[model samples]
Target chain A: MGGRAGLLIAPRILEDVSRGRDIILVTGTNGKTTTSAMLRAGWGGEVAGNDTGANMIQGHVAALCASNASRAVLETDESWMAVVISSLRPRVVVLLNLSRDQLDRANEVRRIALGWRECLAPETYGGVVVANAGDPLVVFAAQEARHVRWVDVPSSWRDDAASCPHCTRAITFGDGGWSCECGFAKPRVFSASVGATLEIGGESFEWGLALPGSFNEVNAALALTALAECGVEVATALTRLRTMTTVQGRYGLRRFGGRTLRLLLAKNPAGTAALLASLDPEDEVWIAINAQLADGRDPSWLYDVDFDNLKGHRVTCLGERRLDLATRLTYAGIDCAVVDEPESLQGEGSVTVVANYTAFREWMGRSTPC
Target chain B: MLRVAVILPDLLGTYGDGGNATVLAARARARGIEVEVVPLAIGAVIAPADLYLLGGGEDGPQRLARDLLVEGGFVERVRDGAHVFAVCAGLQILGTTFSIEGDASYPGLGLVEATTTRARARAVGDMATMVSGHMMVGFENHGGFTSLGTGVEPFGQVLVGRGNDGHVDGYRAGRIWATYAHGPVLAQNPWLADQLLSEVTGESLAPWASVADRLYLERCERVSTRRSAGDRTAGRH
Candidate 1:
């Protein structure tokens, strides 16, 4: 396990799942932890994950070792997917969308994708790939697999992949949800709402995530998909989805000092934007950027956020890389104060802190001292 | 109104590549430039944008994204000097074709005329590169291999961290600058971010001000600063 985080550990733990123990492996850039946790909760299964959100192979192994259950549902890292899948050969694999994450450590997106794709190959003892049908690569790879079952997109989300994986023609999106130009249509529906009514075909139920991002909806759908693949009734899964709790610090609301603070873990371009997109127009913000190796060394992707939604918000910045975060905010025309000191963040209003995963942890550790 | 469009695939584009547009809009507004951002997905109308950004996604997301782009012609339009910046998977999608493993090869946007292959190895952790043009320091964790075609201009030679594709990766076509470094690659290196803006708007930017910023600027001022000033001082002899 060395020094690997829980993200890395979930997969390794799943590798040791005993025979006939249904082990489910879930991996993606984001949503892995959330989807895995949600599925476990929805399925009422004893699950092992980086619910502490460590999300590394070492964390995977540790979580598995710590679990008393025979079945392990893991949130695998794209970096270690192949390595873990080769070792674990889990019963089912659920893959969420891939996005830019830890570029310094992840180098390129394809690198991680290749690792997952190789391990989830069809020839690998008939392993089932429960893939996102909306994503081109996932669907394309599913096409190559022997046992491929696709999960449709939630109603609130948009079909981001718009071309045929075979011919590279534009995929058509209509009331029917998603279809590729090459006649490769998928069963995914693009749904977007603050929350939605999920009809599990047996028992119609409604579940709402406290978070506002459309990405979270996709995460919820991915969770349901994993449950369905596990032979759990859709209604049973949907009914259970309502009783779940949000993972701590992944858009979790907390009371720090006197103000209500929202803690969001953002370490990449897509995640940051998704969090930014979901921000309340009325909330004040405190953005922290970490200089940690895991939080990413570069902060330029901050340039991609649409700060228009945050037209008149008071913003405070923290972290060793505070200037980078501050400057990016400054560049975005948001007036911000750089607090090189972490203690100053206390009593700082109902602030939304969008920081690296480590910065989020440090803030949580400091604000909610054990 | 200055309109910037961010084209994101499912995988790597999630983190905050969209934040780049927000930062640009804020900067443009501070400069009294009107700005608007339009997030474009696969089938959205390909509006002629002033600035185009593609972010990182998983390899499958990149392939799906590349296929989505193959029909849009927007990438070609971006390559025609619409001011394009691509990160991680974004950079991989710009290549002619990217291969995740030996069994599959997905076509790219073909903007930079390069090919990326997912190597049979994982290249993770911090890196110190020696890029050729400007000095940069960023980490690289990738399993892809990027082979730049002829007539391409590299972003820089790796000074201490990994370069374009985490190896000898480089940018090309003079206008477009692609790299594997993330963490909002421009977050710390505002100078390079400015360089990307300059590449698009054809304007020069003011110098960055910070101890690390100044050190990075000084490194940029001296091409061989890493080898000469750092621990390799004697090795430079």
Candidate 2:
């Protein structure tokens, strides 16, 4: 549905559907789907969303057509965010962290960030923007927004954000998060997750999420703040968020070829790092990397991932680019076997499968019992 | 111990180009040669090393890398004796000038007698080439269209995808090698890695059957078979 036909029909459909409904546009490199899911769950109303991860303009049209909800939480791809924002003029746009993802098809991180900065300038975007304060790129892009709600979501991976997007200077990271020597720093976070408690506007809400990792906690905080800006109560949003177990098959336990495995989707280095950080050091893990169109044709970004954290784990590499993963693992001093198939690997208990885009989708398709 | 310095890896080593350094170190270690992989950070003083490597990066970082290298006198050092392996943006920065988008061009280190201008379309796909009678398999993702001078020689001829500017793939002049092929180029071509190591250490390292070699062979077969079956459109970005 990515042809000229879909692009043409999307505008007309969006014009008709978004006439009266409040739209919340969620966009970023990583955590877009999961964060949009959290926002939808905590929206306290019937919300239209692209649950299948179809985040383009066509996807939005299909989603709006599928649901009759007055309020919608749309997950927009970073490259399409500017167009989508101009079309929808969303009530609360959640600008999550921006990082390199699909460099072969997408623009460079700083270029995209610069485009976002131009698109989200105060004169262009009058809506409230919920932005991540810890990521320097996100901070740079969202600072131009007319109204901004900054959330402190400390990033696990900073390689993509090693340099300032504004000045190209090396960014310094400390206990307070990242700051550029060029006078740009993390904004004052209006919403933040301190320990297990989510603090927003001086009010603290305690909740346990089924989604693992501090990244999800950050996602939840950002979503809750966006929901609040959309007039959803913090307590109500928290309750709805607590009920969410998974989004688009992520954090799912599925049986694959007689072995039960927990499926985690990591499309880029930052997401991969977050997924790795969420795992136990000794957990048996299988990484499936594919260089398909959906998974970014170039697997060069794999080198950016700090695989040193997976040193002690029994790791097996699987997928089309399994050899590449194995080669990378070898260089990282991590012992890993390159397996032709996931079933060939000998494991006693439930193994964790961290896969990129296409691989995760393929596994999800295979894991479903007929 | 063989000293290998990866210049400004934090800035220039995007595109998994760090794997080239890793392959060098691992291959050297496998050959009973102790290798020291030194990461020369931005603004660090360039030290004399037997081999120096640089990788690809975005325009901002590439320009920054070129400026730092010029200021630190690393370009002269590389020209003097160091065996250098550069990939994509690294190759561009080593040339006379690199024309980025918006028609803005930045001066390079002038280490290589070539100039890179931003191409009309970026070449992105699986790339194969014949380098020194050896089949080299890798990936190409670059927007620079490079033209070599009369004194410069290409590292290889393009076998599948567009390389350099649809004909040649890389430049090889004396001890320096630069390529747009960056599957960490060395991981997919162990022969080239060994050749570079041999040039640096002045010893012909025996060909050892490594797991990397097995992977390289498999990749070569895959690319060849795929091309034979007329599936040129299968992996192009």
Chain A TM-scores, candidates in order:
0.83, 0.94
Write model 1 residue lDDT over A1-370, tens digit each, in one string: 4435543554333444434456788887777777777778877857655566656566666676676776677776677776666776777888777655655566555455545666666666477777776665566555566676666654323333433445545666675356765577765432222236543334444665555577777777767766777788766766676665456655666766776767878776556667777777778887887756767655555554555556687777777667656666566556777776766555645777787877888878766521
Enumerate clash totals for all models, in the order shown. 94, 0
What are the TM-scores, per candidate, against the unseen true structure? 0.68, 0.95
Which segments of model 1 are wrong by more than 4 Å?
A: A1-17, A45-50, A54-57, A110-118, A125-129, A146-149, A155-176, A188-195, A208-217, A228-240, A249-255, A346-349, B1-237
lDDT tens string, model 2, A70-174?
888899888887777777778988988887788888848888888888889987789999998888888889897889999976676676776677777778889
How would you encode candidate 2's per-residue C-alpha lDDT over B90-134 as one tens digit per residue? 888888889875679888888888898888778888888888889
CAPRI category for model 2: medium
TM-score of structure candidate 1: 0.68
Docking class of 1: acceptable
Candidate 2, what DockQ? 0.57
Which model scores highest in lDDT?
2
